[model samples]
Target: MTDIRWTLKSKAETSHVNNLAWDLQVSDEIANLLCQRGIKTFDEARAFFRPNLKDLHNPFLMKDMDSAVARINKAISCGENILVFGDYDVDGTTAVALVSSYLMQFTSNVATYIPDRYVEGYGLSIQGIDFADDNNVSLIIALDCGIKSIEEVAYAARKGIDFIICDHHRPGEQLPEAIAVLDPKRQDCHYPYDELCGCGVGFKLIQALAHGRGQNIEDLLPFLDLVATAIAADIVPVTGENRVLAYFGLEVLNSKPRPGIYALMTFQKKREMTLGDVVFIIAPRINAAGRIRHGQHAVNLLTESDYKNATILAREIEDFNSDRRELDQLIKDEALTQILEKQEEKRFTTVVFNENWHKGVIGIVASRLIETYYRPTLVFTKSGDKLAASARSVKGFDVYNALEACAEYIEQFGGHKYAAGLTLTEAQYPMFKERFEEVVSKTIDPNLLIPEILIDDEIPLSSITPKFYRILKQIAPFGPGNLQPVFISRNVYEIGQAKCVGKDESHLRAVFQQDGSDRFVSIGFGLGKKLDLLANQKRVDIVYSIDENEWNGSVSLQLRIRDIRPSSMG
Candidate 1:
């Protein structure tokens, strides 16, 4: 039932494993994973282990930082009404919260604006501009968006408003004529790291402004919690500057979280938090505000100073998250049924549509669809006169480029390679769907269609110990690029209690062992149906990541099983 291929690193790369192991005094298995992650040298290993705030890149190194800082300072001095505009998603709302909160420290003339998803759609809307105009706002700092809003920026420009854009999205052929466009992705930009999320970009702007004011950049460390959450939720690579930010951000979260974050965690009992915790716990509650109600609720929660007010807002957002879960599951079930009824499972791509589907949860539904029919997928729903859709691609495929190929049928599309959003007239949906399938089937690498589990190393269960796990725990806040290490144990046998557990008996729990090795408990979430694979204590190969499980006031190392099969099948 498992077809995951186990990929090992090149022998040349593996050769450094021993040297790193000797240098760091860690096991060869851990060293192999470190070397594979490009941490071969002692200095690299040190930097990886110690993510210092001093290691962050200079904010002014980004192109246009001087101009952005100068213009913002002028607006603050003159007391010009300044507006912060951003998207409605986690990245956008967090960016708004970050920049607006930072600016309010210097001047009280700042205001934040998040466009309504259903009403104004995405990016620089004319309605947002009109609101700024009515409020006598002379300057707008656009975050997360406005990279491709050439016309919208010009619209604000003609209305006697200047714009400073802090964005990370790819620029269009014709760049917007804003006062300062601060995206590192611009062709002329020489910013070393181009992968900063929207909030990260906003943080850079804050850094530049602080430097301009002769203030210590360390004062801004408190805001890294938001930047870290955005980095995780936005799914940016956890490397270089991003890693540094997240490292300190986790410290901030665990030590002295903002009142808003404190309120969000009021119900959570866990004292220490990781990047994974931010993604699953904090991101969802913040995102729910935008999905079920309005994004401003999230910004309010982030910016609220009073703990009591933030607690009330957090509870409100929690209700929205609960509603989102119900709608998300219902729509996913309906989309699955639609695919089966249409008999389109054999197609190279999944393109499902229903006019009545909730537009708010379509992106989540698109991701869920891939589990049942693994391929590039798009979930479409009627958004007013246009049929808006969310696109999600499997690993190693570029959904953004696929959308570009079908641009003739699309009204607008924008996002990264793995995820994107677009809209088209209802009449063009069928053609767009056909064209997308054709483009993907022709262009996508055949091997990418199958999901893969890239094993970091092969080790005996005996190699795992308390000290090994203690060192592994140092690699906190894991995400893309620097994933948690996964190891394969070959010829392991089920020693005792291999049975289904959890609700609906959907998980497998067992104790596993190999020749002359101590038994290790394991849990295989969603692998209950594969219990037969352990029949009669057959020799098995398991791919798993080590985890600490606490039970009955005791702690022990356990394998969080990724995949398992009989040794013959593996």
Candidate 2:
């Protein structure tokens, strides 16, 4: 395993930390965390800890909110058939479900459409638009995609269908000629917060429509479960308006969620769910609907009103998730083996292709490859006559920009700086791969090639009182911008012998303590190879996040050790 670089965040001003700590009656450690999150005052801290729906910005403040709202209302007033079109991913499907369900309150002509991943690829597909035409749809609301479908939007226009696009991806130079193009990332857009996911953008449109209809904000609360899921699944920043949305969304998800969401919860015991649960558990199950079968299943599940029907859909999605897991692991192993056999480990980037690889799982596999190679990765599979790929980037690197640099070889591409998808002809794959590696090698900072575990602070374990942990827990709904804080403790020594655990002995379990601190039990997944370093009572520095463990009717705090290394002093 490659060693992870531990970079501790710089301390906030001492006076600010001390003042906040005194005012909040929290440990300096907690105060510093708040300060790092840009919360230096009592009011800010209160707002951060207690998220409020009222904190959400007025939807009209978006670049094209007025236009988007007017178009939707016009369609509703006319009783025109309206189509809600979206991509076949969690973000897109959730957006479709959210917007389409909201519109159903005003009119019954609303219909939802999710393009097949394999047949339609992504974004506004001709098949989807043709379906709208066949159904006599006069208005189409595109979500999570359509930011770059300039030509496709024209195709819809030629058929007398007006489009209202609610998307979050970076746009191409020319936008689609829609009735309204709502994207915070647009060059001309000046929305106060620009980090909303696709479903969040959909939520804003509904917020505007509701405002125009004089509906109370409470009327929209039920839809937040879907928003929170998208916010988690899309990996957007959990700060500002997004923080408020996610905070309330989590509340709705845990209590009185839509039947579809309720059906997906398979935990043995009911527990207070966190964003982590949404990311690792709920998001994957929802995504499995799209990846293994069809994304329409997810939209159906999210929009289902009956619990029994939702459960049946949820069961089908669960089976899809199982099949997806099998394919993911199998392909990930094969890709890794290819890298070794081809001796491509030393390359600046990883671009592997196989004609038979499943398109649905290549993105997941690309992310898995990064765990070992720690480089920009692209996993390719044959899709029709062309080759399709999913691109994943290392921290601080922009894979999208690199893709742009190699745009000549790409037939189509879209995504954020961290993750993207692209398609190209088979003949162009070699050139694209070579150009991509060349582009990343020359432009990327060498430091980014190594994985970084950014530590929020270096605090002694003694400071980890129950009260401190309580306050820290409030600093969540954690994600990209406001990540769960990681801490580093130095000169820690193992008290009990460390032992490998889990399947294939891939995890390490041990008991450790630092000078003047209580002993902590730690579980380090994927750190089993480092167990030898913990032997012989050698001191070491550890990076970890505090996690709660429950077993045999007992609960205790444990270190979810992220990385371990020998003590620098030793």
Candidate 3:
């Protein structure tokens, strides 16, 4: 049988459940979860439950927002050619789509330029700048990148071209000489919500443009569907204003998705969709463009106005996504094999470099390694003369700062606390890798290296009712920061179990008997391995979320199992 561990909420946090219950008008069970998440005030509770777009922070509050908006408005007025330069990832491509579509209403001079993931790597490039200069593009809007393009921005400025940066990545000690820098993380900024993704920041810029042009904010809500997709795809925190954006965005996704999104959903045979649909069905297709081909295809798909062409493009992207999954799995397997052969000692950190690994999929490989090894991971692949690496870290570890410690060896780097990217000369990879391990070994606490599942709250099987499940559904469209509640049910008896329930062993269907009176059905996706363990156990504890399962013309409340472990059979 597999080992099982139970984690209880701290006593001090649990004690505040009553206060949370009174403040939030929720049951003590939900209050326990809120208290565990450190939500103490009523305002925090309201913000968590009911996020309103009206409460979004002012766009001008971001650093350099005023200058950035002014430059763009001036460009529109003069009808000068402007280029929206974006990264190749989903966040960057969606940022480009949002800003370019909004700007297109004012001038046809605006166009989008997505860097080639295989050829151009990431961020602002001199070749791109020179091309824009050659085309006489006077204004450049850098999205999802350019925070650390001090030299590139300076070079563009020297060519009489102005830049307005709308990046959300971590910044360096010095800022670039851009017309306006609009990152919430800037020290000088006073924006209330700081966890915006690149597309979220782009939406704020559009908000500023609408205000500047005397346009109503309602006109922009439709585009929030794209913003929400970026926020979810980029894995940004969904608290505060992000929650509102994603909430309403999901509505638009289900009701009036753009032609391209509609085509994608049709191709996937998803007639109805929720936020989960965007995460699983839509985001991956958009991401595949950047992973396997030029991200311009994604921008085109997003901007496509014809339904027939959108369908074709959608199918094309679907094929790309299929190919991307295969490539990712192959690379992940190879990388895992290399890690096992080289680092079998299980070092505190994993640093793997393969000359043949696909650079586009390294970040994903790094993330998978971090999930499996429960340690800080850096995956590197050969990129021209330099080695490009993606770094992912556990909570409480600042990966950007960790990269900064080895700045001398890194040619360039940027990102947030948990994820970052860098490039260094091929010759310097060994030294950088060694120094990275040394820094992490010395700086990171040993206890933080192990992975621990954070349980939200415990609920007895008898306490689960249809009304409670409805209340839980209202708080959905969940993501980082705002997460789906994970309820732990202790000492549940296994009444029945079904093997290979879904296609390709996609899921396990089972029934549980609680107190020999209440019966509930559950489905566990990717949890098929736990079926054997459950079959051997007389009683078990399960962690799950309540879901509404729809069958042939019928709907019923069901448990979506997360984890299952044996319980004492007293």
Candidate 4:
């Protein structure tokens, strides 16, 4: 068992909730949720629910937007051979597809390039520059990468290739000398929203180019499906401009999906899709190309205009995804065994390695390990002459900072607080692992090691109505920073039936009520073992999210239980 904590929000904000609810003619609970999301006034609430495209800040407001726009247009005017380059991930591949497809509408001189993950590694590579030089490409548009590629950019410049970088990762101390660097995370950049995924940054550059030519924003709405996929896959914050983009992107996906997306949807029985569907279903298929083989297949699938051709590409990617899952599970199981055999379970951090492990799935394995270990984790695999690793951290802890403290043993490292990538000499692995554990143990807050369940509000079972459920879903397109609200119901007791469910009896299905109130049905996935707690207890508190279940042409509210424990009040 693991430690769990419940953090309740302050009730002092209820008065503000009441005022906003009265003004907007909504319930006090809905108003409370709105205020919690920083929507205090009626206007803010309206804007939150109905995001407008005009509300998007002018692309020129981004740093270096003018230069980037001018450079692209000049390339088009001169008919200079332009290459769109990017990393071999979903974000990078989608960014490449977006810009290349958009520019192709204006000029036939455009081409796209994605560096091979094994050949040149990540970001702008000298091999990519050499390829550009040989093709007589005078301009290169690098997306999702090149923010830290000072030497590569300079090398490309010497070869008569100008660089326009559209990246969103945090920048280094000294910027690269490129024709234009358009990253919102630069300390000097004042873009209102800095959490844009790489494709979102690429969209802004194209948006600026369109505006410069006096084109309508509606002309570019078709591309939002790609932007929305990137936003969800990259795990960027779902607030501000991103929320607006995702909101409309879902519409495009549902109403008039691109040929490629439509082809993928044919495999599913569902008629409508959401951001979560894109993340779990579509994003994985795209990412599979990069992980199991090359990302070019993903680009081809995204940009293909013919439904028949896209169907063929989707089949190939499906095979890649199947192979990736097998490898991911195999490596995870091996890593867990290694930890047990080495007796490192008591360590503050998890660091495991195997030279034969596939590098493509290391990041996924790192995340999988965290679900069981619940601490900072790193999974290492042999890459060329060095050992490369992917790092992941639990909530509230900065694995990047821990890596920074142990930078002496690292050859190269880069990424954000929650996730990062690093490489180190084979001889340095032991020292690096030791130092990482020490740093984390000494500096990490003890409470952060335990998992947390944030309860948005405490409500009774009677408060759950069709109207309440309807209003709750309006705040969707949920992700980080705008998570699905988790509500806590106290003094709940089993009413009719409680038993293990599913084939292996790994789930729990029950009916619950409080203070002889209305009965409500709930299903707890993977909570079958908790049946003993309910058998011995009279009352319990449950943390759950309200879900609407539609069965046999009827709709009713269902509680999706997240966790359960004996009632503290009792």
Candidate 1 lDDT over 289-309, as tens digits, reads 888898999999999989989
In candidate 2, which residue pairs get closer than 3 Å at backbone N, Cα or C atoms, i.e. clash? none
Give all candidates' CA lDDT scores: 0.90, 0.91, 0.84, 0.90
Instruction: Report the C-alpha displacement of residue 42, candidate 3, in angstroms.
Output: 6.4
Instruction: Rank candidates, lDDT, best first.
Output: 2, 4, 1, 3
Compute the lDDT of residue 361 as modeled in candidate 2.
Answer: 86
Instruction: Give residue 329's lDDT in candidate 3 (0 to 100).
Output: 88
In the range 284-393, model 3's lDDT, one tens digit per residue, is 88988988888999999998889999999998999899988888889888878887788543677888888888887888888888767877889999888888999999
Worst 10 residues of 4 by lDDT: 8-17
* RMSD to truth, every model: 1.4, 1.2, 2.5, 1.4
Question: TM-score of predicted model 1?
Answer: 0.98
lDDT-best of 3 and 4: 4
TM-score of 2: 0.98
Ranking by TM-score: 2, 1, 4, 3
